[model samples]
Target: MTKKGIVLWALLPFFLGGFAQEAYFPPAGGTWEQRNPKESGLDPDALQEAVKFAGEHEYSGPRDLRLAILKGFEREPYHEILGPVKERGGPAGMILKKGYVVASWGDTRRVDMTFSVTKSFLSTVAGLARDKGLLQSTGDRVATYLWDGTFEGEHNGKITWAHLLQQNSDWSGTLWGGHDWADRPPAEGGIDDWKYRPLREPGTVMEYNDVRVNVLAYALTHLWRQPLPTVLKRELMDPIGASTTWRWFGYDHAWTVIDGYRMQSVTGGGHSGGGIFINTEDMARFGLLFLNQGTWDGRQLLSPEWIREATTPSTPNPNYGYMWWLNGGGEREWPGVPETVYYAAGFGGNFIVVAPEEEVVMVLRWLEPSQIGEFVRKVFAALP
Candidate 1:
């Protein structure tokens, strides 16, 4: 076997048995043919109940999204011009079984900001690069590729691609006008406490800092020698037959020159109002691709090995894999879902839940995050 094939087999341990049956996939050009709930082996009444429950549960946090947004950024008024920024929408979602749409609620076509879900997509690029031998190994230091000031310092040099994917890089730096410590600043710490905090050893401590994630975007962009979105489009998105309407956003202040070409380092969340702003159907297509083990139609869009690594639990946080949430071991992130189920979840309950065992790919948006377990329970109960 070739080196690529050998690597794929090594990664197959997590995806031991999946997609053991055949199923339908939507064609290109944003067209889909859905199955009736009964035809898809779903309980129609139960599915309706689940959909109803999903529509009723609103994001129970702040009444205004801007307040939450400013709080998250902790900076001056965000006037970034690069997006496709999110205009908060009402509840929207869809349920897919074996790649066929079984049921849907709200306006799945409405493009809304899927906050942290962008991290999964960003991590997907890293997976693609690794599969192509760009990074050689996840253990390879990110500094090897990004020799720029981004990874120049002693502490940052120790960070690796795996550490970034696992959110344990603990990389300290300011990018796009946001400080690493500024993100989710501790209530007890004063300014010096956050800025001068000693750098925790990379991969030892898992911290969800968007600045580091944006740094990943920046480094990946530098290595690819092209914009991350362009790479994602040519590589994963188009091959999956996703929509032409979808977009990945970066902050206005995040632009930089690479190889004499200008590029923007997109964020991993809509924290400062720019990340992934995609519609539900497109997001479902992305989910379904993973459910299909990164194979769309006959072509393998992403290496099974990368998908395996992405879904497997990180040592620091069992609940978090490479940007996707693992739902069974140390903590049950989504109760009643299969242990094999993993998901790309965003703030405000935007999620793309994939259950390989159940042959299901479900998406939900704008609901309370706390209510996802109940909602997921309903979906699983209604599954065929």
Candidate 2:
């Protein structure tokens, strides 16, 4: 049998038995017909050229150097992990390193929904606000900035900015089922119904919920006096050369409500449940920026300290940091990840991984949400 066939046969059992079954492989050229490159104003040739350039140049850093070397020798196993995703059925995937599109096996241009990964980007915005003095500190109570009467009760009043950032708000609600009591409009009754129903106090446990993050979006927009997307575009996205082809899924609609007082109320409450979409290259650029400590080609887009702290594990869970995810510390985390590697991972496998020690950044996008953890680990292993 040929070498390629042998490799496939050897990996078939592992691919089929493990989490790889859920992976969605992209076409060889990384083109997604659903979201065509031309429609998004991207040149496929240029994208390929960029990837080629990245592959040619060698990167030397503390952690990912070996992976880089393996890639340089063309001996790295890129195709193995991607094979299942391609044949079995999954989303398109892309792999980037150091601002270069090194290898892509599937539809790379498609803009898939990156579920909670939006929280990581939003956290960066919040950090910017704090760094620029727009936000005092993570310790500042949310009530200090938002209208006093907006959030009800002691728990809501006492909930600090840091609490929200860490997902320790102690708010008893889930954003997925739409059954979260905290999601109810204030006029309907107020948060008093279930705001303080937490089984534990704030900062004691980590619960992944989107309502708290939505509230954070509301708080930031209220403070900045602008929409979240506008602030991100002007301050963050444009600086990184991100195209405006992205969209936030939930905020696409506008709503108006009539209050009990018969006054028309315009609410901008849909900016939560972060789902921001962008092309593969822009996402890779984001990874590169983090790899370079929030700077790109000499411009300091984000403070170095912020990048450091944001990627560091703040809670007992080694997998979580400011808004990013760390790989080394968690029990069920990525196995081969160096202790220094951290990533901003989105739902459906949108990852902006920064291996500072390795001087590398990797971005991967996939359609199946189930492959997120496994795919990240595979990418980490594939790195030299």
Candidate 3:
């Protein structure tokens, strides 16, 4: 045989492997591989013990009430719980009420890319800054926190914190499609040079776009004078006693993998539209913090009033809040859900649901991008 043919044969495994690998997309699936919580230098048994305590006790308050809530769900599945949404296009769903895991289907252990849900998490951090007086108000102009000329035009100048939060920024710029971020000219000269196309007058209508959230992250990091991850860790994650093993996947739009875990953080981008890596349990704890009105262990991470305001609908669209998705009303409504239930939904079915009335927090992480609405319905149906 020819030498060239022999060389090609030798390289066949790598070539075939590359072709067989799945493309990086939202909600891709497989299976849950158990990870040693201790290897990440965290005690899995402690977490389990906490879960057990939560299941056994009727939490009163003051000490680890969040853990109590999670344990409650683990004791039993909701009376009417429906699914893992295991259809060919269904979501890999998990149910947690008061912090305990009740049911999980599909690849429950596999970390999946959750797009846009990252926006809600970013909003929480932004809210934290505002709570600390680092950021004045959601009404503050983007120019107040960021450089005056960072964004161009009257619309950009008129862009307020509220506008960005509600998806009413009117800036029609997008970083997707064939548009390459590497190609855009630097922010220089007048704001006009940036030339943002307006969708409507700022604060007029809702249109979900990526750049608005990315810009919000940029503005937030600037005001806090810290990197986005640091701010989030100090203000939100650490306060909630979340797992430290969880790390955000930077720049690669993918899932956040826990230490010693083999999953990737869902996509690497600074934008809040998507780019947070957290485990299902930590996600539940985060939701529980909100459900408890931002207080944990007698300390207020965020003001209760701020929680109400942030989670409540701030626009004509009743389903959206300050980056969170309100669940009571939307194009897809769920049955048996109280009017008070709200959720932070990410693309590909990453859900951190807070139902205040029921004291329920459900976190669903899946590898199927298109089954979000279906999963939402299943969760509601599963409620006892």
Candidate 4:
């Protein structure tokens, strides 16, 4: 997002005083208990319109997603293990009010690749690292940790954990066989043009590059001394009672030797292939964790301060924060959604939207990008 296009939302506490939310943690193991629209504070018609609007807004992008990723994008799939992804879900969703399942549609149980929503999970892992002192500080240069070439050279040496998390690292070099420039190539650039381009100063420019995000993943894995998926499952997932079905994946090529053992470096998206494949129920649980400011079941899984830092507008990009998307009010991209809302957005229209003021945690998978804001509005219309 451009600097001028971003919006900063400062919330007023009074606006949230009316909707007194009650805690309702779902059972960790089985199908979540459901509540009717009235019980959950939703207008029946408004909730209906939300799903109908999402179903109307199908993937309007180019037809062949795989071909689009490979050729025009020149990015390879993380692995060929999966034969084919079923047709993307037709606007699957689950609405949680006060942590109770208010309404749901489609198959919430289907496991689908959540693309960049994985980044938010990755960021949460980073927060965990800080909590455990794995990372002394976000401002510390990553070169100080790994002496490898990944953080060597002029601009890269200055790249900090914050830079990597916020997409301001602008870190040079290639990893997992994907170059930095390969993400969003210039209108006029040949292969040579992209490969040899000058590096943007670290923590200066915010460019959305999967390779850079992957770099963050690799570095975090090294620091955690284990696979990110393992860290996530043990630290945050299990504690919050997330299911065993969700999985985090990395490209087959993205492997590194850490602590005398080789481990896969997970990426943040399904742009290539692997990321986080999770069910909507699990995604909603994750969202609810954030909605309650990282507290789940009276336990502080993620520190409240970390959530603030993760959601705060980065100097480089107001629309992003620690791999999470900020919903400060803007003219586009969730225009009608409340300013206090922050969400984990991914490719193919997977979104985990959290509206704290409304006590609403919503998950929408495989909906149209243009209709996300409208869907959120429909949800809000249902509430007071």
lDDT of 4 by residue, 1-384 (tens): 554434322233334423334667787896688888887667888888887877778656543556534543443223232222323545588998888888888889888778789899999999999988889989999999887788998888999999999999888877766767767777686778877888788777788888899899989888888999999998888988888899888886777888799888888887777889899989999999988877787788898889999998888677888998888743334666767889999877889999887888989987877678778888888897
Candidate 1 versus truth, CA RMSD in Å, comes to: 5.7
Q: Model 4 lDDT vs. the true structure?
A: 0.80
Sort order, TM-score high to low: 1, 4, 2, 3
**Residues 1-384, candidate 2, lDDT per residue (tens digit)?**
999999999999985543223222222233322333233334555545434433333122122222322342232112111100111112344454434444564454565445456777788888889878998888888888877354556666777777777776765433223323434233444445344453566676666655566666657766676666777777777777666676644332321122222211111222232256566655666676676667655567889888777776756566777778787666647665567877776533456767765445556554333444545455444444
What value does the lDDT take at residue 21 in candidate 3? 35
RMSD each, Å: 5.7, 17.5, 22.8, 7.2
Q: Candidate 4: which stretches are off by over 4 Å?
A: 1-21, 61-68, 71-87, 329-333
Ranking by lDDT: 1, 4, 3, 2
Taking the tens digit of each residue's C-alpha lDDT, what string does model 1 give over 1-384? 999999999878646544534666788875688889998888999999989998889886564566666554554333233344555788989999988888998888888788899999999998899888787998989888876777778898898889998999988877777678877666676777878888889988888877788888888888788888899999988887888888888987778898787888787888776888898999999999898888888788799899999999898889888888899676656656678989888877889999887889989988888888898899888875
Clashes of 2: 18
Question: Which one is best on TM-score?
Answer: 1
Looking at model 1, the pairs that clash are none
Provide the lDDT at 217 for model 1. 87
Please give the CA lDDT of all the candidate structures: 0.83, 0.55, 0.55, 0.80
Candidate 4: how large is its RMSD?
7.2
Residue 302's lDDT within candidate 3 is 81
Where does the lowest 10-residue lDDT sum fall in candidate 2?
Answer: 79-88
- Each candidate's number of clashing pairs is 0, 18, 25, 0
